[model samples]
Target: MAETQRFHDRVALQLDDDGVAQLRLSRPDKMNAIDAGMFAGLVAAAEALQAMRGLHAVVLHGEGRAFCAGLDMASFGRMSEGGGVANGLNDLLERTHGLANQPQQVAWAWRELQVPVIAAVHGVAFGGGLQIALGADVRYLAADARMSVMEMHWGLVPDMAGIPLMRELLRSDVARELVFSARIVDAEEACRIGLGTRLCADPLAEALALARGVAGRNPDAVRGAKRLLNQAADGDAASLLMAESVEQAKLIGSANQREAVLAVMEKRAARFQD
Candidate 1:
């Protein structure tokens, strides 16, 4: 498998031989803060992921002292000059995407992928950055990672779809407390609060390792498991049961799935679909 690199100059996209794609937020000079370029790059990266064949997993991380310092100061400045913060996002929402819905889709698209997405978070993942991380199927945070629900401090609620994502992860009261308080919490506290999967010594390396492991498994089973799990996370009781049936129905007679069972029986590696 030849690795392909997609360079947008602001976001770095790389796909490895084992089918794990890595997307790095590259505007380190400003702590990789969200700006027009970064947002465009993120959308392009998501589009690339959707088009690529044989994608097994993805790892999203930032290149800087912080995962991201949240929205760029320029955005805030513009918001101040205009109506307000809500007005700023409202403009972005109206102009920046397909019918898929831009702001929510930016993070939600990761969840929409057929494969698993693991976010490797470090330093400060605040506001929008934290919301983006929450979109991933799994998050590996550095033990010293600092995170906050920072929108309230700016006199805004999290409108980048953080509420829905966080709702599934935290209890209602706890989620409310975190969002309202806007206090930064360390990785250990994040884990305790159900915001992170593991407190890694080195999050990026750990995320990649996990991606490789998933890639090496039966891709069909792995993808099916992701579908089932994702549905279970947000699905109602009836849909949860139907989700399993629906996913299993797709796998039952599929060539790759059959090969998966055969390969296991023959003690060999399965050759899967592209």
Candidate 2:
């Protein structure tokens, strides 16, 4: 078990020896909804990952039934319709923090890390919660997982940065229909619609397996590859090609990378520089 009391409010952050840092959404009583405190916890977790060294990968998951049930309706009730409150909300738009990150950016912050971030999603991921899952570079989902573009159902739109991230994952029409209809779909449909990377019986186990595999690789090269991929994912074709070339150039003559090749040939563990 983690040192739970160390965390302030909404989430659990733990780092294990295998270079895998797990960020768990820990509001089991509420299905891990995006409450103000939880948002703060998510941001703190991102910062911790940023400062960590020798970290190979991250696994993001929730503590209970639903990965997240989007925003907590009760929290939204706290804000009054007034100039000061509206201004403060607008300030969040202009500034940046791990917690204040637009719903999408909170998850994207993991992507911005120098290591890989994988999300293990199960249960219900509705509205903003679904968008949070989209923030991960890879998602390992349970076969029966339920997801939704849920904002519409609540008379609101997905303002949590779901639009841009989901754009890459779905067709324009498909994205629109889901958003407009607020349709809830299962993991199988999620995979078909490009919302999932893989569907498994045990998502966390699958995610940890992949994380361990990544941890076993040359950390430097893995970091470089992640950077290049991030650049390519956001850049144009020419830029992507250039990024690939640049990354390969750095990896080719590196000692650790060479050891990787030699280790495989010799069938031994790589004695990396670390």
How badly does each model clash, as a count of residue pairs? Answer: 0, 0
- Kindly list the per-residue Cα lDDT of model 2 for residues 86-191, writing each as its tens digit: 1123233332543323344565576578888899999999987887788788988997689999865533456555665676789999999998888899999999
lDDT of 1 by residue, 203-274 (tens): 999999999999999999988998888777754433322332334334433555455445544567777787
Cα deviation in Å at residue 215, candidate 1?
0.4
Candidate 2: what lDDT? 0.72
In model 2, which runs have C-alpha deviations exceeding 4 angstroms? Answer: 1-6, 78-92, 98-104, 235-274
Candidate 1 lands at a TM-score of 0.79
The models' CA-based lDDT, in order, is: 0.75, 0.72
For model 1, give the RMSD to the true fold.
17.6
